[model samples]
Target: DANGTTWIYKPREKTAVMSRIPLLPYPMILLEKYERDAELRATGKLLPVPSNQKMNAYLKEIADICNIPKNLTTHVARHTFACLAVEYGMPIDVLAKILGHSNTNMTRHYTKFSEQLIGREMRKMNEQMFSDDVFLLNQ
Candidate 1:
């Protein structure tokens, strides 16, 4: 559905919001197989993959098994991606584009301000403000 060439969804409703995401090299092989299977299935016009409920259930089960204290929802991955991108110093506007958000403000709502990010920003500001004074020795 991306530019009407790269098929975004594979018989599933999961929206491939990001068009230019670079997939891992090995998964390209698997993707080829999936495309072939999809072609054959489409000849008969059968439904594509089943609903996402089962996959989400599996994720929850895995989280429970692993004793993860937090609630394990499918959206957690998206949230984590946003947070990590911000932590790495990607600008809010760029992060918004990568996340397919309509505006930078929307991305801000999703990003959790971590201590590390706050500290890093504060350090940069301090260095810029005090660089000459800190380096100069006062007698």
Candidate 2:
């Protein structure tokens, strides 16, 4: 954030670190909207929500209302972000940095590869090498 960009910081003593990366346009816009709506400029805190357990309980209730089968929690949202980032070809090192991991090895714990992602990467590589004539095994 030293470069005049907005950043989200984790201030807990255990993980007292902040990301150096700048927010992308859409997220930055959302943050601006939240700041204005919540009048958080003075306090610099995003939300005045209750405990994490209470938040998770509310999330579960909302999930049930929405017919989501899986349990909804903060950790699940983080893992979902990691999975989608991997699937979309974000470099591991970049992802690690964005995730506030000291190293890729630590970040690897969050990455769970699926067969579909592997197949997609293989097909993409084949197509890049051989154009439309590329032939790879069925996914």
Candidate 3:
């Protein structure tokens, strides 16, 4: 958090949500992930929890290594996630809740209305409105 906001994980307001992406769960894949997590994870946690300054420093180092011009921060990551979520058709109300926003308007502020999203939604609407079965005739 670049805004100096600190978070405490409460039972009701869970800080983390664990999910499994739909992929082939091969033993080799699982083993590799476990080994990588063991090397990278902080003690008693799934990932290293560094301070804001340290995290930003790490991001800066990574960006430098990757030759990225933009300064990457946690806010940047959150914004990117918001944009992708909207693009993927996650409801604004749902995304707002996940983003800890009080309203959908705030969520809208986080996402860009890209042409690709518009085109995809329009195509989906067309499919729902008129499909091959909708135009069938019995002779």
Candidate 4:
């Protein structure tokens, strides 16, 4: 049963404890629905949280339903969150906070910038450096 509030799980080894992650509106709504379902099941009923294996199986089913070709796992969701945040220009420190990493280095493992993105940034920099006005100014 959810404590009706979100809690962060922090590892003792790390100073960074998991802090309350504010869910987006849709997810918050979904959480409310799940909580209500859990409440209903508590009434003379037993509905336990699924095991990791069961949860992964369900996640794979969801990916299949969505026609996603890649394998779906819990870790993939975390990685995706980090990668997307990086792509969207979120600072590494902020990403670390979201991922509950005590050190920024730990968060780096989750961030993977595509080669195409790197190339794009390089091209932008090159274009700015080699612009006609800049080149003329150098002469």
Q: Backbone clashes per model, in order?
A: 0, 0, 0, 0
lDDT of residue 56 for candidate 3: 86
lDDT of candidate model 1 versus the reference: 0.72
The collision pairs in model 2 are none
* Candidate maximizing TM-score: 2
Q: Where does candidate 1 stray beyond 4 Å?
A: 1-18, 24-50, 132-139
Ranking by TM-score: 2, 3, 1, 4
Cα lDDT, all candidates? 0.72, 0.79, 0.73, 0.75
Q: lDDT by residue for model 4 over 4-37, one digit each (tens)?
A: 6544344533454546465556765665566657
Inter-residue clash pairs, candidate 1: none
Lowest summed lDDT across 10 adjacent residues in model 1 is found at 4-13
lDDT string for model 3 (1-139, tens) is 3654333343323444432222234643654565558655546553456987888899999999999999999788889989998988889888887777767898989999799999999998878766755645573
Q: In model 3, which range of ten residues has the least summed lDDT?
A: 16-25
Q: What does candidate 2's lDDT look like per residue over 9-94, in tens digits?
A: 55433577765656788877776667665456667666555687998899899999999999999778878888889988898899
lDDT for predicted candidate 4 compared with the true structure: 0.75
lDDT of 4 at 138: 39
lDDT of 2: 0.79
Root-mean-square deviation (CA) per prediction: 6.0, 5.1, 9.3, 6.5
- Runs in model 3 deviating more than 4 A are 1-46, 132-139
Worst 10 residues of 4 by lDDT: 5-14
lDDT for position 1 in model 3: 38
